[model samples]
Target: MAFRLTPQDTSFFSLFATSAGLLVDATRELTRLLEVQPSERNAVAERLRTLEHECDEATHELINKVNSSFITPFDREDIHNLAANLDDCMDHIEETADLIVLYRIGEFPSGMAEQFEILSRMSEITAEAMPRLRGLKDLPAYWIEINRLENQADKLHRKMLAELFNNSTDDAVHVIKMKGIIDGFENAADSFEKVAHTIEGIAVKES
Candidate 1:
């Protein structure tokens, strides 16, 4: 049997997944932008800014949904946590885009494009997982795959940062800024993994 839905549940999960989808789209765009030469950077940056604004609007809608709902599909705290985590994922995506513009990061660092690809893939996994909350019995296997992807993201992040710290010249500003951008990618993966965990919890709770 599946969990019963309320309008509140519908609203929350719809917006939650939409927010994640936008994050994935934004990151993918930024990754593609990073691959191009300087001539193509600004145009992608502008699109990313518009996408970020869309993400913010989606987030606010989610918060409003949470506030006005009478009861939620899960514990209020769990719902709140998941909503906030989704918002964090969106914010990190925006931050990564902003850094692409601020840093004028034309060409991607070695393997950086791969990391963005992984982030986009993981965010897709996460958005897919949220709906599985309604069918808790169906989630264990998917959560396992999501965990593996998150682990892959973790390993890739370590290598990406190692190169940044070791190969780049000793420019503190560069180090600090690149580190933050890299961290946003890491956090994006982490947030998606958390969603997997949240799904797992809902599975156990309902099963």
Candidate 2:
């Protein structure tokens, strides 16, 4: 590890962990979309929106801390980028949940559960990794797992798209709505990978 002239401010790690914890909460709420009746979807979306707002607040706090601090845990730009990327993950998830309610989507395809499971796993591991940012210790495993999950998500996304297009009974409007939701979830997964990538960059630079 590179020598530091000043003791790192520990509060940044806590803020990062708080942001990641909200991600886990948001993804958990996403699972409710699969369980609830169509009428109940708006409630779930509302809950996710609330979580997203909380994440935004956390990001803002982190940024303000970065701006005011004389020294940071890492590069100021890296701290800014990490917070922005974490916020992006929440934004994508919230928007995806909102899409389902907006389109009044019903009976999510079975594959959506798999997607949710992958995202939940991603969020859980991300939250686990946040505290470790204090030392930039044992981070490679986190990014490696995120990359693997992302590849799995990519394959599943393509498979779901193919299946959606191949179904003969669904109407054009139905297919379009499902496609939008499918793409939305994929975007959320991609955002999580972006967070992992940002952390990996930080780890390499600090090492």
- Global lDDT of each model? 0.74, 0.92
* Candidate 2 residue lDDT tens string, 158-182: 9999999987378999898888888
Candidate 2: worst 10 consecutive residues by lDDT?
101-110
TM of each candidate vs. truth = 0.84, 0.97
All predictions: root-mean-square deviation over Cα?
A: 2.7, 1.0
Return the top candidate by lDDT: 2
What is candidate 1's lDDT per residue for 35-145, written digit by digit as tens?
A: 677767777777777887887788778677777888776666677677777777767776776776778654566777777778777777776766666555567777798
Candidate 1 ranges with C-alpha deviation above 4 Å: 1-9
On a 0 to 1 TM-score scale, where does candidate 2 land against the true structure? 0.97
Candidate 1 accuracy as TM-score: 0.84
| Off by more than 4 A, model 2 | none
Pull out the clashing pairs in model 2: none
